[model samples]
Target chain A: MTWSLPLRKFLLYAFIIIFGFVMLYPIIWLLASSLKPESLIFSEPGLWPSEFTLENYVKGWNAVGDVTFGLFFKNSFVISIIAVLGNLLTCSMAAFAFSRLDFPLKKVFFSCMLLTIMLPTHVTLVPQYAIFHNLGWINTILPLTVPKLLATDAFFIFLMVQFFRGIPKELDESAIIDGCGPFQIYSRIILPLAEPALLTTAIFTFIWTWDDFFSQLLYLNTVENFTVPLGLRLFLDSQGESLWGAVFAMSVLSLLPIMILFFLFQRQIVEGIATTGVKG
Target chain B: MRHIRKNTITAYLFLLPWLIGFFGLVLGPMVSSLYLSFTEYDLLTAPEWVGLQNFIEMFQDSNFWQSVRVTLGFVLIGVPGQLFFALFIALLLNKGLKGIGLYRTVYYIPSLLGGSVAIALLWKNIFGFEGIVNDFLAILGIEGRSWVSHPDYALYTLIILAVWQFGASMVIFLAGLKQIPGELYDASAVDGAGKFSQFKSITIPMLTPVILFNLVIELIKALQVFTPAYIVSEGTGGPSGSTLFYTLLLYQKGFSYFEMGYASAMAWILVLVLATLTALIFFSSKYWVHYENGGS
Candidate 1:
């Protein structure tokens, strides 16, 4: 308040604009390089194509040996959609149970669930891979989808539990008095009312599963089974002749879905992630 | 009591899927991994009891120590770097600014895609000899090396990547900043408190809990970092193993080399390390973290 209002406003805007541009440079650079010819990609350092070309897109789309890029996109979508549905259905149910119903060992189970949040995923990686391998689920999408279907992501379960707990207990009480079962109350009341939380879970599940590379890489090997991340990894060649333009082209394409989701549901995603951090 | 029995059954029914997952996907594997740590097992062969040999071997293994050093270095350096940027940006954005939404979105984009293979590849290229970074350095007449391939600089690039993706922490910090009562600032201003004093007394103490949350989360994440390191190093953890994250090393031991027992020991070590660190933070919170509602 001591300084001139215009001066403060000008300084803030200038700093934000400069910082925003810096943060956005990599993405913008990727987009620009995607449009550039392969020869000019590294030659031109600035984030603008001197000579635009669609050669990279065409080549990148067909670059993989046998499988087309469409297959990878379809595979990624299939896995992510299953994961989203799995989290929405299974996590919400678990959350409803934890929030509403009285159960034996509920406290113990809940604490165990919370403890799993701190357990690193890699700790279980070896044995789980062994289990799946024994189950003959290796090299399939089963490894990715099955755990999700079983609500292994305790983070989303915790998020939904918080949301369900916020709903007035009066609704559940009245429903029970009307002879409604727990399932009915969950299906008819809690599920419909927790739309924002469910949306947050759905969006996050889709994006994280789609972007997940490590697990996908571990379970999936064949080109026919590769997800988008694995597919993009194929374009990279550190020892051989690398296709920089094509890689950038596919990279931009890979980020499109996530970028669109972030733009459309920015507030929900931000709120969901922030609240989880604070509440936890 | 009869109603309680029925309700318990119904709740268990609702929790059936998660219970199955907890037992199958999580608990079973965790127990098995612990057992595997003390046994010699390759995926093809049955596990042979080896007692504490795996744990003993880990301490003597230079590569294991290297990974420990690398992971510790990452957590110590990267966590602070990320929190600093996040808090600084959060403070800047807390100002009632125009186009705040646009700026927030732009800043958040990196965190969104930071773990993706494409971003990792982009980072690798950006620090390469002929990449954009070196091209920029060329303008200043300074020769630039391939930063990603240099043992000394490879880890720093990863740290820079970590700091670049500070949007999630920033957003959380922004939320925390917003929760601070505006009345506090107004009251402080009336009391003739300078801005620095106001921030130190009013802002920092209030945000201590949020800071703790961010620190613990960042520490856990920093310790387990794998994807970017894997991608940038091309799964070799090359450039003299400087980019070899603990998880990547464990992955190699379990999957690549098929030393399941060794990897299991490493995993348990990671768990123990994380547990101790988290407990330490929790134990120390009494001294620094302030709870306004006084429940602490």
Candidate 2:
């Protein structure tokens, strides 16, 4: 038997709404919990708080010793921004060379770059840590940010290479006829045209750097240098009683930048994944 | 000849940063890490050659095997579960309803924040003794314990968390679903095939390539799961190491205990296992994975 279109539509929308609520309940609960007082947080499990308080936000800001939450936010921004710029410049340059220019040992280096994408980060973590320690880069943002500047993330290079390959080579030929060198072509034509890919790279790099906790935990010792993730961890570890309210409040604040970015660039973020899925 | 040489020089100049990074950062450390795996080194002292003792010790080490079991269990269980949820949601979204964008966004929010410390903390709280899960259980007249604190259930909670971040895979599947020609569906419908038959015969077979891709990605990611386990278990991998993922144990060894050599050995083992599994997936794809442009 054929069902009425509106009836089927209603069912589908109902299912979507219910599943969407289920998907979002924890985050909604988190936001609600952050607003509740410590005494009421556990007692009231609903998404709507019986009584709301901003004391947790006030306390969590200054919970860590002498290093307020603002410092952690600043540290995260500094690292993320540097990482975004680093990936855009360095990865694009590498991609440009591979996609546009011909050179000696080009095939060897291209294969090597592809191989590194499959190599997990943990396999190199120990020795890399030692190298950074020896170079006095440990405990500083240098170990984290400097690597990005060196185009160490093969994933971005690969991504840009795919995008760059899509751009017609005739554009390069025309630019060359105008006496434009490789650098000039890259700066003027490819860079401007690769805006979407660059934004995708920048957004992902920022979000990943901000979310990375393990490396930050390993390298940064002092609270003053801690990124948002590490600082949020400090909120849990420093207190014996475990300040759930403060923890929840700080956690909510930690996610603010990502949430804002997600909302602002929703299409780009989704498109990036879709493109990578199909092309990759 | 001079022009060719000049072009090579320019290309290398463009690749200067990557060349430096590959040689100085990646290659050097990787070689040294392999060497370190065969030595005994703490952060305080130089690595002294111990000749495969770390590997030998790994087999006998109870905790090592526990982590292996934990990681394998996670990968085996979590990957399929996550993929199923992804494909299911993708199928739902493929129906093409009104306001689908909002649903997609809501579903995707968790994945965007999946690896964050904040989400990990939220997970811990959500499953804690006085948390929402228990409160819901109580409403159903069933008593509940803190799922994360119990050894029997900690890993399952982690698996649930993994499945919750199914949005990325779902989007990939959605793309794949969209790629299937609409004419095929209409033709099948006209031929008296039901929705289920169409999905099974047409959708599933056509979607195998995307399924393979999602499986490999999900497997690798599930194996390397760290932040959630770290935060939920307070970095101890405890409640009797039930949540001690392989990467977490490696981190504790290398960073916390300063057993760099041992951790290096563990890391190498992980790399080999992942490589083999990826290779297996690639090899097995020849049997089942479909390509629209090619013969079976």
Candidate 3:
């Protein structure tokens, strides 16, 4: 009993369009605000610009305490790039050990890794803050970048592990028979095949690091060291000082990088999400 | 013995970096927190052991209960709302229509950027008194106030924000739907199963595990709902403390009020609550979460 295609087709398209609009509304508002003149932001906030201007973008780009957004973007880009690379190298290697390599206490260790996700980061925040403070690393970029270098992004590691588990075990066996060592197989086979997961991890790490406000707010105390979120939030005071237009303008500019990145590699990320679930 | 040693060495080598980090960053601090919760430390001075005084004081604190209520409100409202929105869209996207990936990508942009200060600021404007939301309501002639500042509506706005990021869950559900085997749908159709019935039995049961996974992660994330609330509340949890989530409250006490010990205790209670919730979920899974690889 085959049903008519148009009915299903209409429903699908209808849902997609509606959901798409819901998702794009805030983004559209931000983009529009970014191009609006300062006065019009308050006088008239519309979906389309009444009179388009590049003032907001220009001010936003240059108004980072005379530091310019170029520096902020550079800071964020360096942090995210280093973090993504660290996550890729260390996380995949650790994932390989848990997924394929047979070793003593592997079960116990893998379970411990899983348990990390269950533990809330807030619970550890106090003491970790203390340690960083004691080490005089509280105000440095070391606290943010160093942890990723050491594979503390357990979510990404677990994701890579799940992806690794999906690979045919026979490949490892065949590679072994062919005299390819464990590192060789992991590097040559597992890492390459896990590109989707790797890409997803990279995209997520970039997004998270780019968006991470708390850490930036904590470590980078000075305005010169401010990331985008911290810089944006530094303005909009909820009490008396409410710069809604400026806030929106900055908000829109801040979202552009991640939005563009998503548009570019979202296929791989979505596929990565699906594969992680199924592999688990 | 030789091969096992070699494998063990390899495993340890692979794990060396993470283990060092886990110990120095996660494990050490985790244990230290257990001690910190019992101390009266304020960063400038060494912690003096106060025994269970912190725990005892927590029970009598009104802010503690308020935060608990706020956190629970967030978890309850946010998780289910997110799941429903995600599944609804997943079902729509699962129809294999044209430009499905495009819609998925667009919907997911918020999820990726949602946690950042940018979205939080956007949320502030969207939910503020003269923001886009109120502007739309004004169009409909329904008077709207500053929802983000209002205790009655602040949490709900955050929940809406949470639900809006259902892209990840939707993607997971999409995957689960794809693996449901077309033969089952075919068989169900032959047996006179309608769309709803087929979805009720075949789809629901098969996708229970994915739902459970999403649920647990969402619960964990919801408890850590600090960013939006922090930004929205102007970092003070204003307007009668409406946006004072548990983590936000912890931050206020530890960082703002300089009550590190008290905050540590609050943090532990948070961990306890989440751990309990996760355990309850796992225990209840036997009733609702069906697994193909497991025995009934």
Please say which candidate is ahead in TM-score: 1 or 3. 1
Which consecutive 10 residues in model 3 chain A have the weakest lDDT in total? A271-280
What is candidate 2's CA lDDT for residue B84?
94
Residue pairs clashing in model 1 are none
Candidate 1 lDDT score at position B179: 94
Residue A146 accuracy (lDDT) in model 2 = 92
- Cα deviation of B143 in candidate 3 (Å)? 2.0
Give the per-residue lDDT of model 1 (tens digit) for A99-184. 99887799999999999988999889889999999999999999999999999999988989989999999998999899998889
Q: Over the stretch B194-271, how does candidate 3's per-residue lDDT look in tens digits?
A: 999998999999999989999988888888888998888888776687777888888888887778999899889888
Which residue runs does candidate 3 get wrong by more than 4 Å? A1-12, A64-66, A100-102, A166-186, A237-243, A277-280, B1-7, B293-296
lDDT comparing candidate 3 with the true structure: 0.82
* DockQ of all models, two decimals each: 0.69, 0.69, 0.60
| Model 1 spans > 4 angstroms off | A1-5, A278-280, B1-3
The 10 consecutive residues of candidate 2 chain B with the worst lDDT sum are B96-105
Runs of candidate 2 with Cα error greater than 4 angstroms are A1-5, A239-242, A278-280
Q: Candidate 1 chain A, which ten residues in sequence have the lowest lDDT sum?
A: A271-280
What digit string (tens of lDDT, one per residue) describes model 2 on residues B171-220?
Answer: 88888899999999999999999989998999999999999998988888
